[model samples]
Target: MDQAVLPLSPTEQETSLGSIVPPHTADAYWLTPYGAPGAWSTNTTYIVGHSWEGRASPFNNISSLSQPGDVLTVTTAEGPVHYKIDRVTTEYKDTLKDSAIWDKAPGRLVLITCFMEDLGGKNIIIQASPLPAA
Candidate 1:
């Protein structure tokens, strides 16, 4: 469950690349131009990674064990941000760009990873919102 979050490469950031094939690493990559945690109060923050089949990986548990109401913590330089899972679902790869994942929601956290069981055709998407301040 512990993995580093890497920033996109300069080329990736400049191009705003959104690839289904994740970087060749076990860590997650922050989606560029989307703003980092707490950088914007109303922009969705996307973190993408890979789900390896037949092997343990950082994102593997997201699809296999995550559930609604679960707490997802994102560590940032400023501090940690906590999100309460709202849903977990899968979408066919070809149509994901047009799906509801791109909706503009304030302080939304979205995690994207390949669906290990259907790597060639599907993606697992987890959506959550910032935990209300205590």
Candidate 2:
């Protein structure tokens, strides 16, 4: 896949991270180590995107997809990964949803982006879980 949409390798960023590590990307998808890709345990995996209202990026509309039970697909080197939207909410930058963001079961995904309405203060979060084997 082209990194123009995501990074091929982790690009270094001057950031302060408490867990695993932040994914590298100038304008691509970030796969944080909050949870292992295939690990379906109580550890939450976090993927984040930049919320550019008019920018052409996958996460640009992260805030606008406000329907529950929707599906989000991620194509990786291994194969396609699928998850179903379980929750979506706006959380103040100060008051984050602990249970929703961390210590999650395996096969779960957490997507975060800057809140367009909050002027970069709050975050729009999306939570999804793996689909049942078909």
Candidate 3:
């Protein structure tokens, strides 16, 4: 049977993994699908993303989050959050402000990382939406 072709939108994106800990607290990092493991917290710099081009640039766009086939977990002050891979892409340092990528969806988690230095300092973005309650 032929599959239905659906137009790709920024909402249908993938998720990325990230380690978030309470600021100015102790060595504590939030894990995915699970709470803080015993003493697993450290000044790990909350591994967000690396230099996409090994150059000085602001890594703060959610457009790349619209890529498909990516996964990520979000740990917020509320509790452990999970997201599935939907989309992935790389964008220039200038056009990062395009809110359409993020605003497309609500209560979604986005991961922005730096891709290898080359494609005009592009950023590796992973966008994911919240999973259903257990």
TM-score of model number 1: 0.86
Q: Write the per-residue lDDT of candidate 1 for residues 27-88, one digit (tens) a residue.
A: 89987667566535667888888888777778886776889999888888878888888999
Q: Which stretches of candidate 1 lie over 4 Å from their true place?
A: 9-20
Better of 2 and 3 by lDDT: 2
For model 2, how does the per-residue alpha-carbon lDDT over 1-134 read when each residue is reduced to its tens digit? 12233332333442233222224333555554345444343566566656555555555556676557887776656666777888888877655644347554677877777777773577778888887645
Task: Give each model's clash number.
Answer: 0, 3, 22
Greater lDDT among 1 and 2 belongs to: 1
Off by over 4 Å in 2: 1-26, 29-31, 39-42, 97-99
> Would you estimate the TM-scores of all the predictions?
0.86, 0.69, 0.45
- Cα lDDT tens digits for candidate 3, 15-105: 2211221233212222133212112222111223333333443343334324464444544456555556566666655555553453434
Q: What is the lDDT of residue 18 in candidate 2?
A: 24
Error of 3 at 129 (Å): 1.0
**What's model 3's lDDT at 58?**
31
lDDT of each: 0.79, 0.59, 0.39
Candidate 1 vs candidate 3, lDDT winner: 1
